[model samples]
Target: MPRRASGPRLYLDKKRRQWAIRDGANFIRTGCPEAKLEWAEKLLAKYIAAKYSPPKSASPPIADILLFYLKDRVPMMKSRSAKYNVANLEKFWGDKLLSDVTPANCRAYARTRSQSAARADLEKLQSAINHWHSERATLPAIPKVWKPPRNEPRDRWLTVSEAARLVKASKRAEHLKRFVLLGLYTGSRAGVLRTLEWSWIDLEAGTMRRRAPGASEVANKRTPPIRLPRKLKHFLRRWKVADGGQCKYVVHYNGQPILRDPWRSWKEACKAAGLVGVHPHVLRHTRATWMVQRGVPPWQAAGYLGMTVRVLEATYGHHSPDWQAEAADI
Candidate 1:
């Protein structure tokens, strides 16, 4: 018998009168033995003359790969957004195979997420999809199906007096104090800030690095060192003295690790300062806005804040003094 040129032969189980061997991806054998037998006889004759096909390796099933991610990867991720991502995926693609996840399917998922019952959840799904595609090396091409809803404009920056008051009121709250100071000085994201360690800080050099969640211990993927403001040097020097010899983290409360969620403490800090609606993450925005207002370009401000230029411009630029000043001057 000669070799087949393509896929494996679709065999007809003539004795049982059924078709066998269906590859889920690209090849499907008809269940009717009558159809397969008629085709098989033609194929056997062609094989005798040397023109038949052989089977190829099928890629791993998408559903199995997704299950692996949910079971192993999502649980290991440190970001707060992981749970919501898992939920959105379960809503739309819990059972779909990886090969079956087409661009259209992704697009449809995106569309459904846009009109999601909750707006916050809509963005959550977007990030989840991005995370999913970024995680699985083998996946159908991701499709852009929907644009996120416009977020309301918010000016969450603390006034200078408010920051001073918040800091003073937070004196009794050690971690919040350190977190606020770091937020004011480093302009790093809340996610990266929560995970920063003393090991990543070069005290003498007055610099700290940003590390995203889920990056390998050995791989500081996407995290790069950022130089601290010269103005903050004196404050850190004093902080270091009080921190005692050395610790695994630069920030702590009574020598204990801090919670990743700063909302409760942040709200408390805001209320103590007689301000309302302030979020811990807003301190980051405040610093970045102040920098750009002080003549720093969006690109430089973005790098300082661990954000992209586009994000820096879009989200914080409106609050920039320079932007407002320029508009007034124009």
Candidate 2:
């Protein structure tokens, strides 16, 4: 019998000093330097995904569907959570086939992970299968990925004193102080603040836009421009002057951009402040609750927070002094 055919594989072309895909007799240059093995592997994976045309009635391995989406979609997501979620999903479901995505298996997966995390992971898994089905015309059908019940929206928010203590405790890390202040004042999500740059801030105009100029908007993650509060405006001016030309991101550490979530430092601040169950996201809730308690109109607050009035009323309305007032009076 003739030797069995081999699939395309990564090969370092020593003479060219670049990575290439070896498909039997042909060599496809990957344009990645020999030192960047990760990039070369990703390129190989993309090439494999592009060539994959599953036959109808075939059940594809869950890993292939995930790798396809990981290569194509996750990079475009607004938050890094998708990448992490996909990674966890891959570890659990990579060995399983699409046909294995049964309710029982999903429940088993959830049992091993936290409710919120498992739900998020399964959501990504569902998206990956959907994405795969959309792209592969030869695939018969997509399998359903069961997800756990979503956790209730957290009701935690900082009191004025707690907010003060957090701010004071954050004094140990200037970047963290700026992070807490920006979160409380602007009501922007922690991800938004991590990606915020000096160019988005207009000290002269007294406004700051969450979205960058000319950037495409991600679905459901709107970042409308926020009018700068006077106190926040003052702090921005001082921070801008202090940052000089050294840093680009508004919330950076030691003149370098924060490439990852600063949760460790945030937790440390919470610990020092004598607070528990507090995280960066609570700052957004705190700001919204404060506005509701102070009698800010829901419409105004919603616009300021880049959310819909309905959402504002649904999530934070209970904090409003007038909430259910007529019902209570009866």
lDDT of 1 at 241: 82
**Predicted candidate 1: what Cα RMSD to the true structure?**
13.6
Worst 10 residues of 2 by lDDT: 49-58
Q: Which residue pairs clash in candidate 2? A: none
Supply the TM-score for candidate 1: 0.60
In candidate 1, which residue ranges exceed 4 Å CA deviation?
A: 1-80, 88-154, 211-222, 320-330
Q: How does candidate 2 fare on TM-score?
A: 0.83
Q: Each candidate: how many clashes? A: 11, 0
lDDT of 1 at 207: 78
Give the lDDT of residue 194 in candidate 2.
87
Q: For model 1, how does the per-residue alpha-carbon lDDT over 1-330 read when each residue is reduced to its tens digit?
A: 975455545655667777654323444445556655766555545443332221121343433444445554667665556566656666676666545455567556666755433344444444444555665453356534344456565667766787799888777677777788888887766666666676676678887666533445322224557897787777777877888856556676667666575677777777788977677777776787678768787777776666677777877776666566766887
lDDT of 2 at 112: 90
